[model samples]
Target: IQMLPMLVVVCLIPTVLSHAIPTGDKQQLQWISKTEALHTLETAVRNDKINCVVCSTIVQGIRQLIEEEQVEEEIDEFLNKACVTLDLAAPYICEALINEYAVEIYFVLERVIFTPDELCGIFVD
Candidate 1:
């Protein structure tokens, strides 16, 4: 009777409100930026609180920097050090770094900022 109509309205309210929620991709993209990504990675490394999902997102965003071949000295330095920071157990996050950096590994190497040892260390061991 009256209770049935109340239950129906409650169910409809949830359906209507669900559309207002942001999707995961939207939230993840909105939360990431280069400087923020770098900070998140740095903090995670320092704190030893590496979350695979967050690290993966940061690494994915970092790929954009590498792809455009951004040549600023600071950008170069960040990538060199950031690459060394991935010591977590998630192979995919490490793989994301490798796949993205593989494209410009030599370019990064030629800069003389990161040694071959450091670059290899990220993936090999």
Candidate 2:
């Protein structure tokens, strides 16, 4: 009876090890698009939920989805969608806003090393 438990344990080791080991390629992380980020921001703005906590969460989420090299393009795409979806201003005004602030936005997003919380703290408060 003493060897029976040991035998059972030895028999199960291979089965557990096979399942634990990887058999194929590693999976990649899926990221959201600019449109989704815009939609989320718009919803937060419309619902009066644009506080530091909310902003930090949004920024962190976007940061994870986008790479440093893609910051400028993502900002442009996000702002364009926001202008149309939120209807905050006319097309010219939107264009001007993008022209005026896109570089600053890109600088903050790509060049600055601030964490999402720190970034939102500067802007939100």
Candidate 3:
């Protein structure tokens, strides 16, 4: 029975090793292409006409907070403050989007916020 377990593990080793291979040139190229596309989309979002002053400021703050590698608590605090500021400016915009778009607003918000990973997904999909 011990030998059976060892044999099973030996068989699985090759499978695991095969999957562990580093991304090859083709995969690397694809990733680089996607990354470039993501950057283009981010630039477009930054220049997009839909951005209000309050929304733009919050988006900028989020980008800055992420770039600065702040702690999770600080990021949450910053976002809370941003929301409060936004509430004072135009409270109904977010509500309108949520009420109209519902689940689909995630895609819109992802574009508006423009994080690299999220943008990559938005661009890829």
Candidate 4:
């Protein structure tokens, strides 16, 4: 549905920023908890310098989390909070979108298995 693109972007934000952040910033990130790290990356992606490296990192991170079976509940909680915090849509709409598309999103993420660089290349280039 129309909300799918938004979902993809939300999911990919952390991965992309992981690549875009400077080495010093990346080092700083290593010490943070995963949730804090994700928030930091989310903040970074709001900047204007997004590129292929960022995109690749984002895709790779997402795939890794999914593969590790650590994504479902966290993704749900993260997206729900992000939806409200970012104010990308109305609360009801955001909830509806998450409820409707989470399964399909997970299915695609699990099945595709494209290399981070490859997927990022497609989007970033």
Best by lDDT: 4
RMSD of each: 20.8, 21.7, 20.9, 5.8
Model 4, 12-124: lDDT tens per residue? 53432222222224346433244555555456555534466655555656665665676576776666666666555687877777778777877786788576677666655
Q: What is the lDDT for 112 in model 4? A: 84
Let me know the TM-score candidate 2 reaches against the reference structure.
0.55
Model 4: residues with Cα > 4 Å off, grouped in runs: 1-40, 44-51
TM-score of each: 0.34, 0.55, 0.26, 0.58
The sequence of per-residue lDDT tens digits that candidate 3 reaches over residues 38-105 is 33323433454222322333233334333455444443333333223323223344333333442332
Relative to the true structure, candidate 3 has a C-alpha RMSD (angstroms) of 20.9
Q: What does candidate 1's lDDT look like per residue over 1-125, in tens digits?
A: 43322111111111121112111453473433344544554565567554444433433333344455554444534433334343332444433544454435435433545432343335322
Ranking by lDDT: 4, 2, 1, 3
- Using TM-score, give the best candidate's number: 4
lDDT of the structure predicted as candidate 4 = 0.57
Clashing pairs in 1: none
Task: Report how far residue 118 has shifted in candidate 4, in Å.
Answer: 2.1
Ranking of all candidate structures by their TM-score, best first:
4, 2, 1, 3
